[model samples]
Target: MEQWKDKVVVVTGGSAGFGKAIVDAFAAAGATVVSISRSPDEHGGNGERGNVFSVQADVTDDESVAAAVSQIIQQHERIDVWINNVGQSIRVAFEAATMEQYRQLMEINFYTAVRCSLAVLPHLEKSSGSIVQIGTLAARTGWKNIAPYVTSKHALSGFAHQLRIESPDNVHSLFVCPGPIRRDDAATRYKAQSNGLGDAASTPGAGVKISGLDPEWLARRIVTSIEKRQPELVVPAKARLLFSILQLSPRLGDWLLRKFAS
Candidate 1:
């Protein structure tokens, strides 16, 4: 945290949820946090600690993303860390999800990260900065519902891996994979509406009581990982083992997934 003092940090989709937590955490740690979101914060872009600067940008649009990055650079002159945290999801059966929905999910979840990463690459290269990509557990396995969301995350995971491989030694790319996260009120409402189709269309894991990690805790861990420059951080620790088991024993993995879905 001490290392982040005066650092310029940009977080996309930082107005709420994990993005908001990350923005607040970094701001509290003395970094200049710039939050890029379409909606403006109620506090007029200033965070609780008065270190967050809000910028309105549609990450899905290339020109908008480019302009946002340019504004950040023009103001801060350098970017120390860029967190690509914009994502969205809808719960529905794979067959029920339309191709249009899949494309929309990809644009919001995958393309935003791609556009932002490319937009900031030059500045990051100059600063030897870090790009932190927020991923989901769905990326590691095939889930019952939310196929489009899972597919988009899988694509993001692949992109991040390749980017890390080709990126300069000085520039670091890290991905954070977490399971079902505790949602905020707005997110809960959105999920409810998305699941309103019928009982048959209910979200997978609807009644399951799976404990979720706190956004603040996850944010702190992410900040610490960024400070340490770790390549990847998977929440709950057991997810890594599950990922391995899924790779090595497909039948067992399928059984486990079925149990989870049940």
Candidate 2:
């Protein structure tokens, strides 16, 4: 944490949820945190330390993302960590989901990270910085409904794996996979409308009984992981065991998932 003092960090979709938590945590740790989102800050300005900055940018638009990164670089001169945290999900079934919906999901969940990483790579290389990609348990396995969302997450996870191999030794790429974070209103609504499929609220752990994690706690863990330059992180600890079990015995895993789904 002490090492992060004066470091520059960028978080996309930092206006709310996990992104907001990450932004607040980094800013409190004395880092210059730049938050990019489609919405402007209602508070208008940085935190008390003047370390937090907000930039309104639609990450799906390449020019907007590029310009936002340019502004951050001009202000801070370098970026020590870039967190690609902007993502959205739809709870509709595969057959019910439109192709347009799938394309939109890809743009938000997969391509946003790709574009941001490309924009930040040069700065990361110069600073020996890291890129933390927010992944989900769905990336490891498919779940009921939300096929597009799950697929996009899988794509991002694959990208992160390849990125780790291609990126310079100094530039680290880390993937954080967490299961069923506590649902907000939008998520709750989506789950309610889902076609008898389980979601974060009704099935908080997917196939397990564990509750969702608090955003702040997850954010702190992410920051610590970044400091250590870990390759991958999975929340709740128990999920790691489940992930391994699924790999060794997918049939059993599927059975458990079905049981939970029921």
TM-score of 2: 0.90
Clashing residue pairs for model 2: none
**How close is every model to the real structure, measured as TM-score?**
0.91, 0.90
Overall local distance difference test of candidate 2: 0.82
- Kindly list the per-residue Cα lDDT of model 1 for residues 190-212, writing each as its tens digit: 46645655442343333222466
Q: Which portions of model 2 miss their true places by more than 4 Å?
A: 41-49, 183-187, 195-208
Model 1, residue 18: C-alpha shift (Å)? 1.5
lDDT of 2 at 71: 83
What would the C-alpha RMSD of candidate 1 be, to one decimal place? 2.6
As a whole number from 0 to 100, the lDDT of residue 247 in candidate 2 is 92
Give RMSD to native, each candidate. 2.6, 2.6
